[model samples]
Target: MYLLLVFRAMRNFIVVGHKATTTPSFSLEDIPGTSGRLDILCRAVTAAFVISHGIRKDVCVYLVLLGGEIPKTIRLVGETLRHLNPDERTTAALLKKALAVPATPEWAMSTSGIFVRTGGLAEVLTDLKDAKLIYLREDGADIRGLDAPGKDSSLSGEAAFILGDHTGMTPEEEALIEQAGARVVSLGATSLHADHCIVLINWFLDTNVFMSG
Candidate 1:
């Protein structure tokens, strides 16, 4: 049953890097410095998909970049994910390359499992496809006391955890999230890196699912 749940469940991590570059002009060596703290999103990608021995094939990661004139969303689906190692630099390269692709309001495949779209947080919220949208906030309800995730019919057995970058979401962004009716959840009092939070959420679901199954 544990193995069954592990193979069948789907988990999504969406990180909004408000200052991250939307264009592909940032230097590879300065992802954090020049890319406007894109290093944070890169680390979150590692946490979402990387695991011992292999990738988490059941996971998908969303990166929203809002620095350039237009906001862009880069998606990485782990089931068919390839060419992604567990390093931040290479991941940064992939993200940069994805942004370099031709702009499309619709999703355009930059690589095998990665996709780039010309939109931001609001568009993503409407594309949930019955997935429950959860906002990770320090003041929300504690995440420790939740039921098994991705099992509700109303949600079509899907859920996505949305996080903000180092600078956190702007007030306007926060208002948009709340307006979308996001279920806010807390990780604790102390602040944590977005990547670390992703790890914690993944572990919470994986462990709880294994135990429950």
Candidate 2:
């Protein structure tokens, strides 16, 4: 009976994306509480990978950037895989893909009162850092921290504001725009005329594609 239970668990692990080459070997003695050592072995192996895979890539990048041997990163990734939740392990894979492409370009938009003017240099690029869309470099310029393929200048004015500021919108404002399927842009320096601001805000808030599943 114990052997049969162990076999069943092993089959389940194989079905759930375990690669045969890297699977760990387990002996009955390795597991203390189990009546069936084989079953415990299977559980240990599956649990280890499911929890660690998501964090593996990030940890690898960190270690490599620090000038350490690359092999160490691989071992660390393997180690981290032992502790992450299974869902997080799966999501990490998806996050890696999502981060592969640049989300949008960064450009400056002008705001007057409630009105936003797309195009032209941003009156205040510094404010974008506060919104988390861009990070301030040592030189005091805001830059996209993610390794996006194209030149930073390729970003459009509207895209910059949208990426920079939408996350900070008020719940009411966000809800209304979300309900209307509108795109939101960063609210920067206020315009002189409220009507123009309204038009710009409305336009900016209505243009993004939702990608999260």
Candidate 3:
């Protein structure tokens, strides 16, 4: 009966194609007044950067500030077009590049610049997804092919359990995950790290589902 109960529990948790409604598009008016005033250009840039960085929820709050600063930056650039020093212009360019990098879950965990514990990554993703602040695509392609073919395909039952990471999974477990609809992408053969999870998060963000608000 114990084994049967376990089987039943597993069966109940299986993922299937349930029609989830499409997320609405983001609009500037949707932002709360408390978020502060921002120009359209900055809002667009901040949204793009946040989505690219794996949909890190911690950084989303900063978008409110970025929205306001964009116009100021543009005004500064226009005012100093002729008088701007080469060094200052270069510094501004570098700052723009720095803002382009998306904040990741790992980066959020590094409070003191140290590596975050492995267990924390899954929790962060789950919380973000639950809050509706971040949308999660189960298992998908890299950023380049996010819009291409076979992107929204659902993962198989076995694959969902394996990637769920209830406890430490093994090589055999990983094989089962692939069989269920997941693609096991590794940075290196020796590295057991799960990088594809981040890829899926980025894909969701790229779709701009969460940015609507």
Give Cα-based local distance difference scores for all models.
0.84, 0.23, 0.25
Per residue, candidate 3 scores C-alpha lDDT tens digits across 53-111 of: 23222222111112222211111111112212233233223323323333333332211
Worst 10-residue lDDT window for candidate 3 reads 8-17
Clashes of each: 0, 15, 4
Candidate 1 RMSD computed on C-alpha atoms after optimal superposition onto the true structure: 3.1
On the 0 to 100 scale, the lDDT of residue 149 in model 1 is: 46
**Model 2 TM-score on a 0 to 1 scale:** 0.14
Candidate 2 wrongly placed segments (more than 4 Å): 1-143, 150-168, 176-213
Per-residue lDDT of model 1, residues 119-176, tens digit only: 9999988887467778998888888656644433122246788999888788998898
TM-score each candidate. 0.90, 0.14, 0.21
> Order of all candidates by lDDT, from best down to worst?
1, 3, 2
> What is candidate 2's local distance difference test score?
0.23
What would the per-residue lDDT of candidate 2 be over residues 1-213, giving only the tens digit for each residue?
355331101000001111111111222343222211222223322333332334212111000001111111011133223333444233232222222322223321111101111111122232222221221112322222222335343222222122111122235433433443322322343322222332332232223112000
Candidate 2 C-alpha error for residue 34, in Å: 74
Highest lDDT: which candidate? 1
Error of 2 at 14 (Å): 52
